[model samples]
Target: MRWLCILFLAVLASGCTAAPGSNQTQGISQDKSQQGAGQATCAGYTFASAEREISVLAGPGNAIGNEHYQRLAQALDCLAKTVDAAKISSVRQQLDRLNPDVKSVSFSAVQREIEALYNAGNTIGPEHYAKLDSQLASLGQAGYDISALRQQLETVRPLAEKTATADNPAALKDLAAINKLPECNGQMLSDPPADLGDVQEISPLGNIGVPGHTLPTPHLYFHISAGRATTNTVPLLAPGNVTITSVTSSFDELGKIDEYSIGFALCKDVYGYFNHVKGLSAGLQQALDTVPCADFTDNPGNRCAKDLFYPVNAGTEIGRVGHLQGNF
Candidate 1:
């Protein structure tokens, strides 16, 4: 509570974004040859420079009141709302006060100031608090003290029920149990099966360097192969070329341990070229578009059964030319 109040007060006082000006474009004329480039350059310079030039219009001696001055005024709207989450989950809650809202803010420096409020105050407005809760909830029930969490929620619920930032407790618990498994850290949680392939569990204490859990939030997406899986058997991919880029799930690293591992490989990294991605007779391409990865058991490989596999519903074909965007 103390930290939250401190962070919120800091945001209220900081002189941050540009003053509220017409977002509507101003007229600009240029030679046909330089038109596009000129506009881009102008937009960059004017937008960037005009920001600090604007005002916060503090009500008190040094305090600013304008929303435009603080990060909350300039955060980018999340356009990824429609992007297929598939194996991944996201919370719409407020972020740590130290973090930045890179999604909406043009200036990374400004955005960071906004993120400082991540877990700061849960009582300000429900929108911010709700997003924070939803994110933590997705961490799964492995190490969370549900009762304690609920107690905190009870306090928050009454004041901000109208603005939910967290997900339903029952939903979070169900997801955790579905993927529950013992690991070095504790229980490894799973992503409920998705239209795109879902992970059974992120292996704990995989190798010397690997951590006990895998979280998609930090972009560490991985999955362990359920059993023997391949393009032919799993119908997840057609055969062109296969190579693991990064593995998020782990069990053992030194010797071959096929039971728990998740590896990532972009289509562009696999096959040397792009096409309709007819490789997986199934919707694996579509799944790849969502997560584009498989569970890794060890450095050698992991098990993936046909049923456990989830292909991307829409994705691009891989090729030497690099990412050619399309959906199969």
Candidate 2:
């Protein structure tokens, strides 16, 4: 029942390697005049100045706390947007040289590896599982917060351990049979779900900013300017032919803001979801109305969702996210 969640953002599909654009204005003023002034200020930054700024933003030990990382990311983003491209590149090179031990690991990549192992628990022989498990255990020595990953491994451990401890011929035969089945090749996306130009910045995976994203989450954030979002000008297209499987609506009492999350199945094994969508399209809303939604609300926030099937073709306009940001 666990579906691999692919966080699609703007024009970049799951496997696409397009370089990120240089328009990042998240947590910054939206006024053109202010932006120009900021850019001018940033243009004069030297490597030393940039390093100081990063140190101040990152705090001691370069901790990946939500607020700390957000500030650091925003600062780097500002440099990318305002400073000369070469200057920014030089700054990164200098920083890397100064701290060679500071490696940038994508949490999503690790999560994917763990998920693959978990998914293949039955098929992967016990010896292979043990070897992989030992390798994963070594990741803790690298100072990563692998608590969540450890919990995930625990779910698959019992099955692997059972096979390792006993001479269950039936289990071995079942595993062989499962391995003989044809692989499930999911459908590839031919179109982007959203307009790339409309997106101010497509944040890298494992971003830490908002309260919901304390840890490095397996999500990509598409930041849009306030003006564009308020006008509901962004379109949420279907990247590929997919069946809408679930829709969740969340209402924040303090902010009094309402948002939606859409989950869909691209193929037999591949599934994806989008969060913080501003509004559902008319057709999607009608389909959602057919089912009774389950309430899973907390005080100051009300969340409800309905599970249903509503198929759409690639490039179909299913919804729009105009509420500042979209997470997938």
Candidate 3:
């Protein structure tokens, strides 16, 4: 979570407002917030804050399926060449002819097999040799002469070192390939939504509380720019097929203005938020109004039935992609 904070500045609204002449000093109550806009009025919700509007630059759609497979293949190739079981069997046959004690035979066969694997370019690090040395010593205690096998092991150690050498270079290449994928590509301001033209001079994303700091920060959050902040009349379009998840409101105590925030469930574990949006279309607002304040806790107490949104065009809108917490 701290990493998330560092990479992306999460959503922040303008400020909170208490009901007029009401001094209640607690966060918004779940029961009242659950009522959403259906309640008698805004009177039910507390801690209403000012909501400021900002647009985000969305991230690219993650690569999946074939993309993942190709990446895996590349990674595998870099770390080690696949083992040749047929070649291994052939070497084992040669070692079997030595027909020494059971311990010596097994130990020598393993040592030669490690050499074969290295010669085949499988990833054999020094640790493999170190473990083989321990095993050979144990076998020696059992009266197996490992002298011949140990000499052969020493002969192949340099080649084994070479097998370990490829990994760093391979890893560098893998990193380069990964950086080109959509998931790894960083965010940038996007072209305007269909009806909206390009935007210019919107506020830079950063800590809302920070002073005079307006620069784009690294974030996984998906964003869509609604063109430049002209008359605040531009419509915020759905980046993709999505279900409205949560609707939040902010109020200005001094200005008596309210701001609305909308959350869209893009997919499982993928969510997006638009903050400080003004003048939501009636349909959009109604959709948001009905969304419940869910328990987003690690152990969720009351999880909402997230609506499904699909076929969302990549790069148009960005959703916040997150991983689950815990061991599999």
Best by TM-score: 2
Runs in model 1 lying further than 4 Å from the true structure: 1-33, 40-125, 137-151, 159-328
After superposition, candidate 3 runs with Cα above 4 Å error: 1-198, 202-231, 252-256, 288-328
lDDT tens string, model 2, 1-328? 1233333352347335434442444223346534543444443553346567655634553423445444444455576765556656755554443341344445666677666543321123355556445555556776766665654453334333422344644334323433343355855767777888877777677765433344454556666664323534478999788777667676522224666767666664555677657788999998878877543444333456556667889988998765433333
Prediction 2 TM-score vs. true: 0.41
* Local accuracy by lDDT, each model: 0.27, 0.55, 0.36
Q: Is candidate 1 or candidate 3 better by TM-score?
A: 3
lDDT tens readout by residue for model 3, 135-166: 67777787886664554343233332421345
Question: How many clashes show up per model?
Answer: 54, 1, 13
* Model 1: lDDT to the true structure: 0.27
Candidate 2's clash total is 1
Best by lDDT: 2
Q: List TM-score per model, in order.
A: 0.16, 0.41, 0.26
- lDDT comparison, 2 vs 3, better candidate: 2
TM-score of candidate 1 against the unseen true structure: 0.16
The residue-level lDDT of candidate 2 at 303 comes to 54
Clashes by residue pair, model 2: 7-328
* Tens digits of lDDT, candidate 1, 213-315: 1111121222323323322111223122233221122212222331111122223212111111112322333443555222212222232211122222222
